[model samples]
Target: MNRRRLTRWLTVLLMSTSNLLALPALAADEAANALITRLSTEVLGSIKASASVRTGDVTTIIALVDATVMPHMNFKRMTASAVGPAWRQATPEQQKRLQDEFKTLLVRTYAGAVAQVADLSVVVMPLRASPQDKEVVVRTEIKGRGDPVQLDYRLERTSGDGAGWKIYNLNVMGVWLVETYRSQFAQEVNTKGIDGLIATLADRNKVNASKG
Candidate 1:
């Protein structure tokens, strides 16, 4: 892999580790560990086999992403929140289209980054404060042979019985990915209307499909 691709994969892995940190300790950690184990065993192994047969096969990568990563990520909510006021102004169909397209874009981007998962270890640290009543930031460290990187998860409670924590943002080495996306979305909405923004996302999705 090129240096740029490796850097992108490292960024995605760090973001995943960071977001996995925001839950209520063991519950969140257990859920994430289970997911990782499945991915490492079933999904990763399959991807490796496919790569050995046909190196850099985009179809296999996208398939692995859809099966393993897309199911775990709440891209609809993330996209809706990132769009901010534009979501409120959009029609129902428009909102749905935007969400679908944006979700696909994210899935493709993250799937492409999955190539960066190395033999690194993710250590979930204790939350210094309680998150029972409100949102909290959980911290963790992704350690490798090189320097350890810090990851922080910004999560909030869903509307139900507080059964799960939904991750809305993640910080890796001090960079917040959600906030960055929000800013980019805001700029797009400013330059182009909501429909234009939706079109932009649709165009990106089309590009991703073409690549696959």
Candidate 2:
């Protein structure tokens, strides 16, 4: 997808997450919607107010994500899923490296997308999910200029440290994030083994860091 499309949906994704620093006491059924609530505007304000954040600075965005986004995402699950079956073959260290690099890639890309957006507001749709369900799709639309853009999330309920209904994947314009990365990751794994894929990600992150 083009950068603008990625930016549009990513802005929705990133802004929707700022409130995750504190999960609600509400049940899982309501938690997703509540988490995606208008409180997210709080983060948007913080971002827009900061000159660094508005400039698409990865360092600034990384700090924001490290605090808000990291705690609520199933990054292990996200990384594993994106790596496909090759994840099983990876050593623990390799797995950790993959997760770190993948996360950096996403944060840096998000930095760019979020920077370009100056007019956007989120409207979360009613979540059609059962409390008994372990996984659910939370649909939302980005409202600003022109027609609203569609963005959705895939969250699975979990327990343990910093756990609630954590996001494992995201969907934008009918494109699933994990699946999109999987196609690219799988190709690198096939050509150069798991280590090769890790190296590629590391190289990419270094380039991104340099650009920042």
Candidate 3:
């Protein structure tokens, strides 16, 4: 994707993550829509207000992600889903490293785009799902200087104490984030094998980390 499109998608993804942070306090069924409506503007406002984020300060952006985004994301499931069949074949240590590096890669890759959130507004579409369903797709539209972009989220409900919803996949302009990465990751695995992919990710992360 071009940089502008990538920036818009990242902005929407960050807003979605900010919404997820409130899942624990909401009922499972109401969690998705409520959070989306409640925090969409707040997220945009925060990003616009933060000088460090707007200036692409990696440390601040990474810290914001760690604090607000990571907790509500099903990174293990996301990484596993993105890796596809390769996930089951990898060793536990490799899995850990993959998740770590993948998380770092995402945080670093989008750190600069957080600034692009300015002037954005989100509209949560009407949700369609039965109350008993464990998973649902929350559709939304992000509007700014251009046409509204379609951004959707797939969330699975969890049970037990303090349990609610966690996001596993996201779709921006009809492109599923995990699947997009999955295709690229599959290519890397096909050519370099899993270890090589891991090393590549680790090296890329190191370079991104040094940018701040």
Candidate 4:
């Protein structure tokens, strides 16, 4: 092969490898940003439109939470793991009931918390690192009129396969709410059994729904 042709082929190979290495990082960033934007907009918009002047806003918010939020949640895995060793001992019916009620309560709680969206803006910060091929953490600052809150969305990438870059965890003000709930849930299951825990969640959700 001629010297020029050999050099050209080598240059092309190098560029192709560089692009391949760069693609995942770039895609991860884009996916993370898109999730951040879409969720923040949908959530904030729902709150603003429903926070007042509507009695059925709670229902609407709950629907939105279930539709947009629930799919992204790893609720079965979350609940099973959160319940710890007790989860294994529960009857099939008990497990089903626990997962069902826990999902409902979490949706309601998250929907209720949307009331705090008033006068809040989220600033998506630069990611420290892209940790996995399928997941990324998008750091953000949530500034309310009262105080600035640190938030992070731990996102999973599906990348146009179907509603890509879903959020599985939301850290608000340095509190990983899901993790906190998981720990608390483990304790309740330890002390009271799965059925008792389900009852507690139902009661808590009832109160929360009334408030909403």
What's each prediction's TM-score? 0.69, 0.88, 0.89, 0.69
Once fitted onto the true fold, the runs of candidate 2 whose alpha carbons sit more than 4 angstroms away are: 1-4, 7-12, 23-30
Candidate with best lDDT: 3
> Over the stretch 17-81, how does candidate 1's per-residue lDDT look in tens digits?
32233334443434433433333234334434444212434465445544544334555667777
**Ranked candidates (TM-score, high to low):** 3, 2, 4, 1
Order of quality (lDDT): 3, 2, 1, 4
Where is model 2 poorest over a 10-residue stretch in terms of lDDT? 20-29
Reference-based lDDT, residue 39, model 4: 53
Model 2 lDDT tens row, 74-114: 88999999999999999999999999999888877567666
The deviation in Å at residue 120 for candidate 2 is 0.3
Q: What is candidate 4's local distance difference test score? A: 0.56
Better of 2 and 4 by TM-score: 2
For model 3, residues 1-212, the per-residue Cα lDDT tens digits are: 46446644454455335533665656444567776666676677666777887767778767676787767767899999898899999999999999989888887777766666676788999889877888889888888776777778888888776477777887877888888889989998999999988988999998977875
Worst 10 residues of 1 by lDDT: 14-23
Considering TM-score, which of the candidate structures 1 and 3 is the better prediction for this target? Answer: 3
The TM-score, computed over Cα atoms with residue i paired to residue i, of candidate 4 is 0.69
Point out where model 3 deviates above 4 Å.
Answer: 1-4, 7-12, 19-23, 27-29
lDDT of 3: 0.76
